[model samples]
Target chain A: MMYLFFLTALFMGWSLGANDAANVFGAAVGTKMISFRSAALVSSVCVIAGAVLLGEGSSEGLNSLGNIDSLLAASIVLLSAGITVMLMTRLGLPVSTSQAIIGAIVASNLFFHEPLHLESVSKIALTWVYSPLLAFLISFALYAAIRWIINHMRIHLLMIDHYNRILLFIAGAAGAFALGANNIANVVGLFIFPFEKAQVTLLPFFPRLSTQLFFLGSLAIGAGIITFSKRVMITMGNSLFELYAVSAFVVVISSALVLLLFSSQSLSQFLQHRGLPSFPLIPVSQSQSSVGAVLGIAAARKGWHSIRRGLLLKIAAGWVATPLGAALITYVSFSFLSLFIDL
Target chain B: MKLFTGKNKMLMSNIDSFLQLIGDSSTYFHKALESYLSSDENTFTEYLKKVSVIEHEADELLKKVKHDLYAFMLIPDTRADVFRFINDLDNIIDSSKQLLVQLSIQRPLFSPSLSDGIISLVTVNCESMKALIETASVFFRQPSLVENRALAVIRCEEKVDAIGERIEREIFSLESSYSLSEKMQLSQFNRQICSLSDLAEDIARDLIIFALKRMV
Candidate 1:
């Protein structure tokens, strides 16, 4: 019976892998620089590695958003978030799973009469707002630096092409790792609170069962990538203004950096040890960061006129709709589940 | 396995093969013209067959170059420029083939005065194509030498144009011993031969742009 509740978490993991994996390798696959088969393989391996090793830091942040004492409530929240994400993905909008799960958690908190941690919620909210803008600024600066290097170095065009492909593969792998690290919390963090007393040892040398569960969730995400990410990959590759291979490389690297900064615990601790303020470890929207980086490159290349404003507006609309849509779905689903199940 | 092989080497090989085929086509065009002027019907047929074969080979290489460019990631900055440049070079080969075919079919009688000028135009155009091939090859190896070769192509094109125009003027200024239709045919043939040089000049100009892009 307890295993039934875990299915929702796995479903959420699958949804994330199906959708968010596109953020990691979409540009590479879309531009035909990397084959979809290779992209999926690398993404799955890197994402699982990231989730198993570095997932705990941002999971701590997500855990503080709301503490749901009931297992049923946790299952419903994940299900609602997963459903909302799946819906938005079907509509071809790259909505963030981080936003969806947070919205679902906040709604479940309200539904269960749990007290909301306004400070943690607001901090996470602020990062959501700041991440895309940071990604844009970083991408703009990075592109300018790269262009300067290319011009001054006078590298042969063929060499630049070869270098771009190599760099893109590295960046895509890093981005996949960052996505798995930061966003695994959205899939399995809620279940951690309910499973606190049910720890099982997977390996004597490894940590507790909670980490094992996170690995399982991440594996489900990888399964999702293998099974259902091809269409989204194609859409991402061709839909936006034709991305040059260099611009695609810049966007992936910059967004990966932004995701890494928000989720790297060691970086935060290092800053804190130096008596400097550290960035809050928060789960940020990889989709927003990727789009923001693309926009930065576009603006740098042709100014605002070159940007596809309609596509931007549609994505922005999906961003606004995601959290609200997930919140409402969580509220309604929880009410329905309460009639047949103990809360 | 394919990725480990340097794409530069592959791109260069495809380009070299394409240039070689274009050279063969130009050779056949020159031979066909020589056969026509010397009234060797059997040799003209043989040269026409050779031009046709070389043109087909050039077309095949062009298709391979295009497929490889799309399939493998070449230099991002100049991939499109290289594609357009190769396309223009292909046009030069295509013009040579078309010129040979017209010469074989029309068999326009060239007056002795126009024969020398026509031969000179073909020779100069062939030199222009040869210069372009050198410029392109140098562009891949030593970009610094491309400018001098490209200038030579321009110079050859100008000579071809001068000879072509003079021949046309000579044909029109001929007495009624040449029919109106015959003079028009001669003038058309002269323009067709000049067009080969014109196409080479266009490609040379594009090569200069590609070279400048690389230097910057």
Candidate 2:
């Protein structure tokens, strides 16, 4: 049964690599700055690097839900979440795997009446509201600043372009790294807990299995990035704006800052200790923060007409629907799986 | 009518060549402008030749840049912008050359201050471009120098703006010997040149900010 769950997670991660890759390119491709192939290549490398170096936070979240006590339950939870995500992917919806994982844990807990961590759940939901808002505000100010310097100041054309390119490259790379550091746990945390419980040798030379799993989770995300990321790259480079390097820098910096702040484990722990409560480790969607920042920049430039309200709203709606729909599917699937194996 | 006739085709073509050459000369002229304004005219004559050669080369390369851009399988990432920049620079050259060609052909005497102001702007513009190129060339090695020079370039634009205001006043105060149409055409031409210099200055400003990763 545990094996089935592991297989399901593998599928989820694979789909994630294919689906979420679109977010990386929407802007780059739309602007004709990069071809789909080039965007894919860059994103894949960056995503893989991101996942391996930063995959810790989400893993911890999966462990705290108390769903990893037995191999069978862990397997069920993971399998159910993956299946739910796969369905969402097929429908072309950009949903958060973090939300799916949490929803599954919540539904699974009902069967045993597990003492639910309402505090953590609330914190997680709060981030959903805060991350995008923070991104929008930061990007808005940055763009306003950039426009002012370009218009009001005296300068040369070529120099401005060169500087913009350099800044964008640095910020974009940082954003990718942050995405990996923050999102890796969404796919690997469930599996890691069972290894910890089984007392398995994480490494012959080292006894700490959790750390090993963290490394593996990060590597898997990196692999996902390298193998499939063209679509998302196009969406980012082009569809977002007539992005000069300055605008690109602003968007990347804002999105990365927002994701890192919310996903940082030390910060989360500190918040929990301060009587603010904890949030589950879930990959905050880079797509959300990036789009919010892009829109913020565009609004600063051309007012509301600059925003593609219909498309942005559609994507936003999908974010809301993914976890809800996934939770329903998981609840039903688990119910069916349980009927076959009487506990 | 005589200008448009077949017998004068050679003359028109010569004029076309001159206009094209002047258009192409801006980038190189900009380089010379940089050298001259920086008080370093060690290679002023060489700078002049380089500007001249660039125009000659543009005549040689124009068909090709146009043709290749059309034929190439343009990587989606690099297509629009590269072409846009090249074309825009080319248009600036064409307009500048045409202005000179018209003056030579018509031999209409105009206000000395307006022409002097235009010439001065050319100097300021060259300063801006020089600063931009030097800053770009040494950006990674000395970000601050690039930034400082870019700031200086931007400051020079203010002088160009002041000159523009003076030129506008000159236009309104011109004597009644010339027809309103002629005055309008000449004023519009001056305005275009001023606007172009301002745009070049704006581009320089953007570059500096881009390098610094912060707006100054």
RMSD of each: 4.7, 12.1
Off by over 4 Å in 1: A27-35, A87-94, A150-156, A199-205, A238-243, A304-320, A339-342, B20-60, B70-88, B97-166, B180-182, B198-216
Candidate 1 second chain TM: 0.95
A326: Cα error in model 1, Å: 2.4
Candidate 1, clashing residue pairs? A30-A237
Query: How high is the CA lDDT of each candidate model?
Result: 0.81, 0.59
lDDT at position A168, candidate 1: 78
Global Cα lDDT for candidate 2 = 0.59
TM-score of chain A of 2: 0.79
Q: What TM-score would every model get versus the actual structure?
A: 0.82, 0.61
Worst 10 residues of 1 chain A by lDDT: A197-206
Evaluate residue B52 in candidate 1 and report its C-alpha lDDT on the 0 to 100 scale: 80
A112-189: candidate 2 lDDT, tens digit per residue: 567877777676766666766778899999889877776555443433544454455456556656766676666666
lDDT of 1 at B88: 89
